[model samples]
Target: MPHLNGVTVHPDCRHFRGDIPCRPNKEYGYQCQDCPVYAPTQQRILIIKLGAIGDVIRTTPLLRRLRQEYPNARITWLTLTPAILPQSGGWIDEVLKLELTSVLHLQQREFDLLFNLDKDKEACALLGSIRAHQKFGYQLHPQYGVAWPVGELANHKYLTGVFDELSQQNQKPYVQEIFELCGYEFQHEEYVFDTHDDKGYDWSQLPQGRPRIGLNTGCGDRWTTRLWSDEKWITLINQLQQAGYAPVLLGGEAEAERNQRLHAATGAAYLGTFPLPQFINLMHQMDGIVTQVTMAMHISIALRKPTILMNNIFNPYEFDLYGRGQIVQPDKQCVCFYRGSCKLGPTSCMEDLSAEKVFEAVRVSVPLA
Candidate 1:
């Protein structure tokens, strides 16, 4: 009913922004009244999954199902790591970082559907505060002052999160669990990632005529229990090189010194770590990947590269590699389940998982050229 200049403004349009000029208008100088690319927002959906970068990346599979279910929905994702999320032409219409400003803005809006995947108190609290016609996943219980599942569908995932034994017994992959929580069945939906191919990054330093294997050396600082020894990595590098595959070292700034040492020791291709987007592009160049249950593993899976996931602490069933990778565990069962530090003091099950075992898994899993 209201006019901006000569054209009537449609607030329900997906591209309509009250504060700034809409994208369609800015790009094509088109008014809201007769805009050709006017996509009306049907439902407003909020997804609250503020967690680790890897967790954020893995949660992307739900977008596929959401788009199919709500084709005209204006989806907004709230996360701690916004950069990890796919930007343009992706499922999410808006990506908001978890902060006071974002919280204030979110509190002002009402959604048709709200899904708070994280069980954290802050996340649950936000879920309780947000106005939505239908709510799913966890929410903060006002009386108990704790996070509780919204419905029976979320009970399984909630129980697993609380109890280690139940989590270990869970045969369902993460995608299936999330789908069930949202009242849908899992259908092998793939991760939606922006590979950043248009960046034009030159990766010619890696030798040609050989399959490039990315060796993600770090398991992040939080989970030191998942870390493999440097000696074992060196051995794996040598094994890869001998097998006619180019071994490339991949890690974040935390693993820079170790990666440098490994590179110097084994003459492996080590293009020092770049930013998140550039690092993703670097992983894209790899034919296969060998990594602990870290961000690299998620990135490799999203890229659809054949991967050898060296795991011990977490449940193997939790990860869905989309039939592109194999999970290799240690011969000795890990005493510390879901722990940051090894309960067995000096001895670790990771030592039991030898370089030869990993190399063999790589050879079998990765289709070498």
Candidate 2:
């Protein structure tokens, strides 16, 4: 008798597959539910997607597909941040914070399958070291030179990132590309909001009125070229108020001062700021989101709220809004496509976008009621 996960693997069982725990061989009349390895040696799955919040949130759709593929498996996730994905939700059994010790400890375990979708060097390097019966997505070279896709299905995604021309030419949506890398069909899968981040609030009390629209001002620090100017936001807010919609300012502490200025300038309610969880909940109170591409945009889409998304740096085709929103780009063509930095110096391409374009888009996307 050989033991794995402290369960005996019967020598006579036909489900023995080299070095792995034995499974039930129905043809041999050996049922796994009746066997010693049933409980302790059940399928174990691991997922590694560490974050910048928005990426982690967008990646939540995989939980559904992974569960569909491995119903019996108890899934464990490794992430840099905690609580972005559900640990209490029925789908995920555990979430291990990414640390050296945690990685080394996880390395000791045997998994039936593993999925690593993060393009980070750290994640790719770890994926290369992990032991799994099967692995999908990118892997760092053994010498840790660079990350590359582990499967041919991921080749397109890999090539797109490796070559700027390919990225510009690629027409596949970001979500679809990621799903293909995992050998899973996209099927128009949507993200699940199991994040325990909700602090909850009374929606009736928070500036209730016709067509409450959130003006998300910040777009993170990585892509400066992607951000629309504060002048543009102020102009849009002023226009929105005149158009009979209550525009509320939305952003982290980074935009607190800017929100104050916008609020004072336009009387657009500065509903004030909250932590990430509370902010997300506040976003739920809004009827529509008018935002530059950011984490709020991801939340809005996840909640299925209609939006007028502004995009300039990235290609419009990269975003799949699931028909719940419309993308409004500047009148002028962007010189910085996929490049986080601007090529036009002080005169940004997003400056070409007018308040009328966004206002009209918002009106059409979520008509004021």
Number of the predicted model whose TM-score against the real structure is largest: 1
The alpha-carbon RMSD values of the candidates against the true structure, listed in the order shown, are 1.2, 6.7
C-alpha displacement of 236 in model 1, angstroms?
Answer: 0.9
Per-residue CA lDDT of model 1 for 1-369, tens digit only, reads: 568666698898888888999888898998877789888899999999999888888889999999999999999999999998888874888999999999998999999999999988999999989899999999988799899999898999899999999999999998899889988899999998989899999988877889899999999888789988899999999999998999999999999999999999999999897999999999999999999999999999999999899999999999988888789999988989989898988766888899998988889887676
lDDT tens per residue, model 2, 207-256:
66577898898887778777787788888887888888888889988888
Which pairs of residues collide in model 1?
none
Task: Give the winner by lDDT.
Answer: 1
Compared with the true structure, model 1 gives a TM-score of 0.97
Task: Assess the local accuracy of residue 182 in candidate 1 as a C-alpha lDDT between 0 and 100.
Answer: 89
Pairs that collide in candidate 2 are none
